[model samples]
Target: MSLYGEFSVPTDAFALHYTLEQIQEITIETERVVATEVGLTNYFWVSGCNLDEFETVSEKDPSIQNLRRLDEFDRATLFRAEWTEQVDAIIFAYLEIGATILEATGSHDEWHFCMRFDTHDRLDQFQDHCDDQGISFRLTKLHEITQPHTGSQFGLTEKQSEALVTAWKMDYFTTANVTLADVASELGITPQSLSERLQRGYQSLIANTIVVTPPSD
Candidate 1:
């Protein structure tokens, strides 16, 4: 039976910690971490930072294989980067243990990983690898593949889910109620960050639940 495991690794222990310090919000999609001869190249989108600064910091990092901007939006910037072996080994350990990565996201704070494997033994192998390497991480979730992916049904991160729920309960989503700033204050995040989180969460919800069908021919 396939199983899913989720883990959190501190930014201090993650490879892209420096990049996170430069950018504000990074939303990772399913498509990530393609390994290459040089290293593992990954793609993601970020918001609330000067592109030039991101480029500069990434350029100086030896672990970064290559960094390039793919797209620009009013609020977010899309980017791709190849990472060196130093980082790739940590993530690919699951692969070595016969597991597949379903989702991976890194931020200034930490990295969140969701992976699937055929058996508990594989997961145990992964855990053993982490312990042998003395890698610091927290296994936040684990379940049989029978259960849906966390946030997969809703297209929201744990933090985003909490923020949205709090906003709704506080009447921030209702008319003549709290302002974005007020909600942000309650969440202890800046208004801009809160706005981005809400926007992304709503977009995910729409994409996942509101599928439109074409008229029958």
Candidate 2:
């Protein structure tokens, strides 16, 4: 049976060590990372930084061979960066085990991953490979996927997860009894920023969790 595994690999063991150091709100969904090439042309978001500042930071890191912004949105921008030999082995390891990376996000300290493998054995083999290489990793979750994971099955970024949970526990959505500003203050962000984050989080939640059916013809 196909299995889903949630694991974490420290930044020291992967590439993008410097990019993570410069930006805290950055998230990466690696498109490809190989011996000769690497591409992470995904939205790289930072709460209050601009393109210039982002580039300045990227330039400081030699590990990042190239950094180019493909597009920009409200608080995030898509970027592609090539890496040196450091990340090759790890990327190849995933390929070796036939693992499909579903989601990956993190900073310079550590990274979190949700990957799908053909079976539990493949997941174990991947972990064993990491162990043999002396690469430290922590497995957070492991389960068999019996059905399509969409809508609510989507995973939340750490900040989004925290924000949503906090808001729920504080009853932030219970009418006007509690204001968003109150929740924003508690989250140490501006109300506007909080709203944006929550809105994005909700959109992701709805897209992943909700089941939409088509009408009969």
Candidate 3:
């Protein structure tokens, strides 16, 4: 079975916001999953997952801390992908039940625009929810994800992938100029969180991509 899936629709599929307070609440509830699942159907492209519905939380009020290997975000997403046999399920259906909205702070504190949802869904469900909510969420089908598209190819998540990339991008020599605070700002996350992501990414990078760059003449 495919791990990640993507779908596409008209450009004006999901509106970022609405005027009505009720609509806003719907936005908030569904948003709890995150906007990552908004556009793309594929698992990798889809950003967030239903943190509230996570098994840890479901079993007995398992908080975000229950997740072990990955952060809350990655665990939630993985749960969705692996929880169900069908990879293309409607992750946002939880919204109709008034799922609690956990505003996504920002993605990996990497970029301003990068956002993720704690939700996962098939491209079809994502589109339908957009329609049901009177929004314009769409789907973009990906013909193929580039080789080494991400660490998931090697059983790694985006955060893991970033750590790998960042380490290679910077020599262990120094990110002295680029403080954790700066990285966090770039990623729209707190410095401490950035450090965690960086450390994980660095370890993965070292494990997978550790190699010496040719010395400059």
Candidate 4:
């Protein structure tokens, strides 16, 4: 008794984030044009009452979880109706899980959001769900957009892998860190050449990694 047949939510399709709760919040801000902001038409939620003590803990206290639908187009009405449908789907899924949540609260022609929480193992389960659904969900210890200098998992040349690993360990971020020139000196290569190699390594890793954010275009 349904629209198509049985609720065949493709075993492959799952949620993006592993848990309903998260600590660091990623604020993706965009400049509003004539339309100002894209609004979420509405969101639907269904709840899961089965989880035991964890549910109680989540109910009493929850963390911040956010996913902003960051997309942009010069013109407004480009993907109008379809955008609303996607937002609705997010709401429905969160509600079904007994997750503490925030339904889409803002409006922007191309922006939308939804959030929820779960912890540790529960978070892992959430990530599994995202994997099945083909959504890219990754948690980071640092909030900045980091360029990982690691090689892709499938395959990478030894030198390429080493270059990427070096990029990650450079401590290029902090004030008291050594410069690329210092590392390059140890490697017997000029800093300029080292930078080029690091760039290549970061690009390779990015091509295969699962982290997803707003469209960079």
TM-score of each: 0.61, 0.60, 0.33, 0.26
Q: Write candidate 4's Cα lDDT for 30-114 as tens digits.
A: 1111111342222111122222332343233212122233322221111111122222233333443433222221211112322
Candidate closer to the true structure by TM-score (higher is better), 3 or 4? 3
- Model 2, 71-174: lDDT tens digits are 45476555656665445435654547667655566665787777778877777788787887888879899888786643223545545667887888889987
Alpha carbon lDDT of residue 12, candidate 4?
16
Residue-level lDDT for 216 in candidate 3: 44
- Measured on C-alpha atoms, candidate 4 has an lDDT of 0.34
In candidate 3 the C-alpha lDDT for residue 78 amounts to 25
Instruction: Put down candidate 3 lDDT per residue, 1-217, tens digits, no spaces.
Output: 1223333322122211111111212111111132243321211111233444333332432111222222333322222111121112233533332222111112221111112222344334544655665653333333333353456333344654565465546543374665556556655777666665555445434534553442342
Q: Residue 24, candidate 1: how far off, in angstroms?
A: 6.6
Runs off by more than 4 Å, candidate 3? 1-57, 60-143, 147-149, 172-175, 199-217
TM-score ranking, high to low: 1, 2, 3, 4
TM-score for predicted model 1 compared with the true structure: 0.61
Deviation (Å) of 59 in candidate 1: 1.2
How far residue 39's Cα lies from its native spot in candidate 4, in Å, is 46
- Candidate 3, residue 79: lDDT: 22
Best of the candidates, lDDT: 1
Q: Which residue runs of candidate 1 sit more than 4 Å off their true CA positions?
A: 22-30, 88-91, 147-217
Question: What's the count of clashing pairs in each model shown?
Answer: 0, 5, 29, 31
Q: Report lDDT (Cα) of residue 11, candidate 1.
A: 60
**What's every prediction's RMSD, in angstroms?**
6.8, 7.5, 13.5, 19.7
List the candidate 4 regions with Cα displacement exceeding 4 Å. 1-155, 211-217
